[model samples]
Target: MNEQQFSKSMTYAPGLPEGATFYSAHKKRVTSHAVANAVEAALKERGVTIEDIAEIVLDLQKPFMSGLTIETCAENVRGVLAKRELQHAILVGIELDRLAEKKMLSEPLQSLVDQDEGLFGVDETIALGAVSSFGSIAATTFGYLDKVKPKIIGRLDLEKEGKVNTFLDDLIASIAADASSRLAHRVRDEEEKRLSQNNGK
Candidate 1:
């Protein structure tokens, strides 16, 4: 088919559910802000601020993509926080952790989730899926985060004060990985654009 015809065919019909849309502004704003707030609060509790996350992002990105400043890394993290898919993943993963903590699951499942069995692997799976959008860099970054367990992630790994963060530790790592990947891509795009302009000149 022609490009115009293909484009026309891809448009959604009216009256579709808000969830069916690629980007529901209201849902995106609310969920993204909530998830961002939760992340900030968790980090604050562990004595890690946004500046720390920015520095971590800079560390994660500089080796992969050159000329990336700390300010750009911090802005990219905010960009990741604004993404609808990231928000959804954060909300869902945290909800699952909360459910497990409450022992809401049935029978053997409850015990398995509560104990965070190695064989289960569901928590990592969810986190991996969240980072998949950013490609292979995300996978490596996630491994780095998992290994280092910086700040909030390390805190979340420990069960303290009757709070369980079984899924959250992995989820937070994925978030950082994804944010780093986002920054890398943005930097790459800008570099490409500059190179193209120079070539044209």
Candidate 2:
């Protein structure tokens, strides 16, 4: 069959889109929900409860917007997770953490993961990529969260018997920071909308 005919004959699935050829048609793309699920599972494995995540969400939102509900905080998290680049970063960071925990990396790399080396900044660097989604505030928020290590983050940072959360800790902090930035932007948008309506009236 001709290339054009082959392309025209391709059928795409719900979440998959057809490409110029049939080989690319069945390729599966990662969705935001999948990224969120991976994050949630990692948190759960580390004993982070849903309530703990909710508390972080609330803490991040309360300072920027008054009377914001937990539901809204969750929605912000979902929105932040939906970004494709952010998802890639989270997955990659988490996978590195897992590989480190398993001692699957090279000698120096494995040692850094095992010892939680002070000079090893690679994990933090990976997490930093996610901060740009929400602007400078996200970076500031991440710094704060990293310093304070509140809620489950504190738990992750604390040395445990058999667990290494070096990367997970940073990943979680970035997520919270991103969520906080999202909430702040959304709150500002709503305030602007209200003011616009009042001026119209």
Candidate 3:
């Protein structure tokens, strides 16, 4: 139930079209699974079980955005990650964008920019995983997490191309916090479903 397996060939593509179930479901599965694993691992580290951490993470990681979208989720994910890691993600995304803008681009990373290739979004997925992991924490600094949780797809920076480190971090912190909170909801949902089945049996 916690694991998400998808087609290996579907990580990256040109763009996320408006109505694409595979893309949407795949991204959501990847995101939820990452958050779930993070909660489980964090609780384990603290000598607890998945059920114990569920409520905490859910209270922590609710999405800030009213309606969650990939772009918005990505923004919150980036900020919610952490200081050093957010910086890294911003830098990586910036560099990728910059590389795409360059006069002469290399073949290896070109697909990453052109969006013509399918594997370009791998880095984004990884960065989201990191944020989900740390966002599972329920520290007080989570105010920042609360503040930025609602704008999952909003702009991180006003006029800059890639200065999203500080900007996006704020938003992502909220997303992470909200996502953490959602963990409790998800776990509870799973438990209810299981109990209902057992009762039927």
C-alpha lDDT (0 to 100) for residue 115 of candidate 2: 75
Name the regions of candidate 1 deviating beyond 4 angstroms. 1-52, 64-69
Give the clash count for each candidate: 0, 0, 32
For model 1, state the Cα shift of residue 185 in Å: 1.5
* Lowest summed lDDT window (length 10), candidate 3: 162-171
Instruction: Name the 10 consecutive residues with the lowest summed lDDT in model 2.
Output: 13-22
Native-referenced Cα lDDT, model 2: 0.75
In model 1, what are the clashing residue pairs, if there are any?
A: none
lDDT of 3 at 31: 38
**TM-score attained by model 3:** 0.30
Supply the global lDDT for candidate 1. 0.71
Of 1 and 3, the candidate ahead on lDDT is: 1
Residue 175, candidate 2: Cα error in Å is: 0.3
Candidate 2 residue-wise lDDT, 33-140, digit = tens: 555676667667766555665578798778766787888877777677777777778677767767877878899888898777999887788778888868999999
- Candidate numbers, best TM-score first, in rank order: 2, 1, 3
Task: State candidate 1's TM-score.
Answer: 0.69
Superposed on all Cα atoms, the candidates' RMSDs to the truth, in angstroms, are: 8.4, 4.9, 16.1
